[model samples]
Target: MKQNPTPAPIKINGSNIDLGEALPRKIQDELAHVAETYFGHLNHATVGFTRDGNWYCCTINVQVSNLKVIIAESSATDCHKAFDQSLAKVGRQLLRRKQRVADSRRVQMSAAALA
Candidate 1:
């Protein structure tokens, strides 16, 4: 039987900045979608925002499994924009990581078998 895939949990933290009430929910939804698309299921994700002068720096950390963790970061004038940029980076990283993991687990045919 096939089982339904659940989105990974996400935690958001902002340092010296107000994330607004709805932005957090929106961010969570978007992050969950991205995580689900690439990893099927992940342990969890953490997003941190910090204001550096005029730019907002956003950092995203995704725990793909017990041993693998992916991190991405971006800086922009707006926190949302920074997050969007970082999320894009995360998606790319996740795809590459998935490919590597899949390749590593694939069984290779012995030379004798091909002969």
Candidate 2:
């Protein structure tokens, strides 16, 4: 069995925000798995948490490729919830990208077969 490489630490930027320490380990593991399973390689990831009057906002930026960047954000009552939501949003985007590539390949194959 082969072991997976560890993911890079997420960078958090904002004053008066300590969400980085509060980030759930499960979410971090899920993000690492997403990188390996979807992107095939780990890229840089940045997570930012901010607080408004009554809400918390989380923003995540993932660099999938040299020209492709995935950004996801969410606002919730707390930092952890917002962060989880943002992670899920990013996962959905990655899934969509994978599906698009697979669909394109299938279409090309069918076209070639009919040619």
- What digit string (tens of lDDT, one per residue) describes model 1 on residues 87-113? 999999888988877776663434446
lDDT by residue (1-49, candidate 2, tens digit) is 4444766665666548764454656556767778667867657778777
- Residue-level error in angstroms, candidate 1, position 63: 0.7
Q: What's the TM-score of each model vs. the native?
A: 0.83, 0.78
Off by over 4 Å in 2: 1-6, 20-27, 65-67
Mark the 10 consecutive residues where model 2 has the least summed lDDT: 19-28
- For each candidate, how many residue pairs have backbone atoms clashing (under 3 Å)? 0, 0
TM-score of 2: 0.78
